[model samples]
Every structure is written in C-alpha cells, then in structure tokens.
Target: MIEIKDLHKSYKMGSNELHVLKGINFNVAEGELVAIMGSSGSGKSTLLNILGMLDEADAGSYTLDGIPIKNLNEKIAARYRNKFLGFIFQSFNLIGYKSALDNVAMPLYYQGVKRAERTEKAMHYLEKVGLANWSDHLPNELSGGQKQRVAIARALASEPKVLLADEPTGALDTKTSYEVMDLIQGINDEGKTILIVTHERDIANMTKRIVNLKDGIIIDDSKVEQVKASANV
Candidate 1:
C-alpha cells in the first residue's frame, strides 16, 4: 500500500544543514496497522510528513497505491492527498466555530462533494465513530476524546487509502487513550491501513508492527503480537 526506499531529508539552518532522515527504508502493506516509535529528533515526524505528502523528501522514492509521489505541483499534491491519505493529529485540529458535523464535512467540501452528500457522509462517519449524538456540539463543547473522535471521523470522511495518525493518544488520560485506541483498532480490523506515530510503548503495542527510528534511520522493525486496546480500556 505504501513504499519508501533510501529516503533522505534535510533542513538548512543558517549555514549548516540539519540532516533529519538519513537513508531510511520502509514499506507498509494493505490492511496492516503499524506504529512508528521514536524519541525527540528521531525523524519519525519527518517520515510521517513525507508519508502524508505534506512535505517532500530531499532524496529517495515514495509510492502510494502504485502512484509515484515525487516532483508534483501543489495542485496535484493536494489532489493526491485528498485521494490517498487521511490524517489524525494529536491536537485534533478542528475549527473552533464549526460544529462536530461541520468539522467532519469539511474535507468532503474540499473534494467538491455536494451539501446533501457531504452531510450524509459526515453523519455516517460520525455515527461510525460513536459521535452521532454529539453532531451539533462544537469542539469546545466536547471532551478531549470526543474531539479526537470527531477528527477521526473527519479523516475517514474522505475515505483515503491510508490513515496516518501523529501522537494520536498523546493528550488523553490512560483510559481515554485506550478508548481511542480501541476505536482505531476497530477501524483497522475493517481493513483500513493505518500508521500511528507515537512514543508511548503501550500505544505502539496496540499495533501489529513497530518501526523504531533513531537518528533519522529505522533502527528496528519487527512485528509483535497485537494487543487489543479494548482489554486495556
């Protein structure tokens, strides 16, 4: 579903260049739940950004669902992002004034989905995330978990091939984190390819595979027995 080979990224700082990702190689198959785990400055976030097509790699290749992801114009990049990737951020990234339903519908709006269809798809995903009853509530009106669920629903509304979550359970309490992970696990069970970037061991264990990054390279990549988040919840 996703492929990366010899990936390299860097940023210029004044006269010096900060090498972020150095010769990283990775691949993810369809219907797999994977976690990218790293400490500060380990380059996991850079890898995520490249995988999401939010940023370009200075070197190497990335192919998503048979489409080469290099040297595209912003218009084409945005189109591919909408067509291939869904994102879940730690902060939820919801508009303060938009209700949960409206927030979920925003992506569909960008895709030029009509009002009626957008509303239908938004409500369907909201219900899937167990947030149908809170559709009218604004981000400020919901709990942290509820807000993240709304974000997840918004991400899924586009029906992208890959889901990339950055620190998905970082802000919540343990129980709430488990609940969110449970929700994510359920989504993966239904054959959605999901990649979560997190530092928390327990959260990474919830996934089927863990890719450990250090100093801009993958240090360890291994599959583990998946731990069901529902048990922890």
Candidate 2:
C-alpha cells in the first residue's frame, strides 16, 4: 500500500548540513501492522513526517496507494493528505472546547459532509472506539485513556487508507497503553494498514512487524509472533 526508495532528507544549520535520513528503502503492505522503532535522532520522526505528507524528503520516491508523492502543490497535497491519511499523536490533539462528537465530526466537516451525515458517521466511529457515551464531553472531562479513545475515533472518522500514529501510548500508563494497543490491534485485525513510531519494546512487540532505525538506516526488519495487547492489559 505504501512504498519508499532511497529516501533521503537533510537539514542545514548555518553552513553545516546534517543528514537525517541517509537512505531509506521501505514498504508496508495493506493490512500490515508495523512499528518503526528508533531512538532520538534516528530519523523516525522525519520519516513519519515525510510519510504523513507534512514534510518532503530531499531525495527519494514515495508512493501511496499508487500515487507518487512529490512536489505536489499545497492544495493538492492537502487534499491527498486529507483523503489518504489518519493521524494519532502522543499528545491527544483534541480541541479543548469541542465535545468528543464535534471533534470526531471535524474532519467530515472539512470534507464537506452535511451535518446530519457527519454526526451519524462520527457517532458510529465513537461507538467503534467505545466513546459514544462520552460524545458530549470535552477533552478536559475525559481521562487519558478516554481522550485517546476519542482521538482514535476522530482519526477513524475520515476512513483514511493508512493510520500513522506517533508514540500513541507514550502519554498513557502501562495498563492504559495496553488497552489502547488492544484497540489498535483489533483495528489492524480488520485490515487497516497501520504504522506506529514507537521506542517502547513492548509496544513494538504488539505489532506484527518491527522496523528498527538507527542513524537514518533500517538495522532490522522482521515479522514476529504478534503478542496480544489484551493479554498484557
């Protein structure tokens, strides 16, 4: 579903150029649950940004679903990003004043979905994330786990082709992280492609495959026996 070849990125600081991603060759098949694991400065975040279309690689080819992603006009890039990707972040990027329902419906609102249909779709996803009861609650009223659930619901509301999560469990406790990972596992079981950027070994174990990055290169890529997050929870 996704492909990258010889991906390279670098940034300049005064007169010096610091190369982040030297050369990254990667691929993720549809329905695959993969983790991109790296320590700080490993370029995982840069790769994720490139994949999310928030940043472009200095050199490389990226293809999403079959469309080459490079040099897109801002308008076209925004459209493609909205159409193809859903994001979950370490910090639950929820609006404080918006109710769970409203937050979930926000994407559809941008998609120009009518209020009635948006509400219906948002409610469906809320229920899917087990947040229907808290639809009327604001982010502050919800617990961390609940807030993440709301975020997950909001991400799913758009029905995007891929879910890009950055340290999704970093803010939660072990138990809560397990619960959230369990939810994520269930979603992947249903055949949604997911790529998680995480440094946690246990969290990486929960995924079907692990791609380890160090100094901008993949050091290890292997499929493992998937550990059930529910078992850990």
lDDT of 1 at 181: 97
Candidate 2 stretches greater than 4 Å from native: none
Q: Enumerate clash totals for all models, in the order shown.
A: 0, 0
Write down the lDDT of every candidate, Cα atoms only.
0.96, 0.96
Per-residue alpha-carbon lDDT of model 1 for 1-233, expressed as tens digits?
99899999999999999999999999999999999999999999999999988899999999999999999999999999998999999999999999999999999999999999999999999999999999999899999999999999999999999999999999999999999999999999999999999999999999999999999989999999999999978
Please provide, for model 2 over 1-233, each residue's C-alpha lDDT reduced to its tens digit, 9 standing for 90 to 100.
99999999999989999999989999999999999999999999999999999999999899999999999988998889889999999999999999999999998998999999999999999999998899999999999999999889888999999999999999999999999999999999999999999999999999999999999999999999999999977
Off by over 4 Å in 1: none
Candidate number of the best lDDT: 1
> In model 2, which range of ten residues has the least summed lDDT?
73-82
Q: What is the TM-score of each candidate against the true structure?
A: 0.99, 0.99
> What alpha-carbon RMSD in Å does predicted model 2 have with respect to the real structure?
0.6
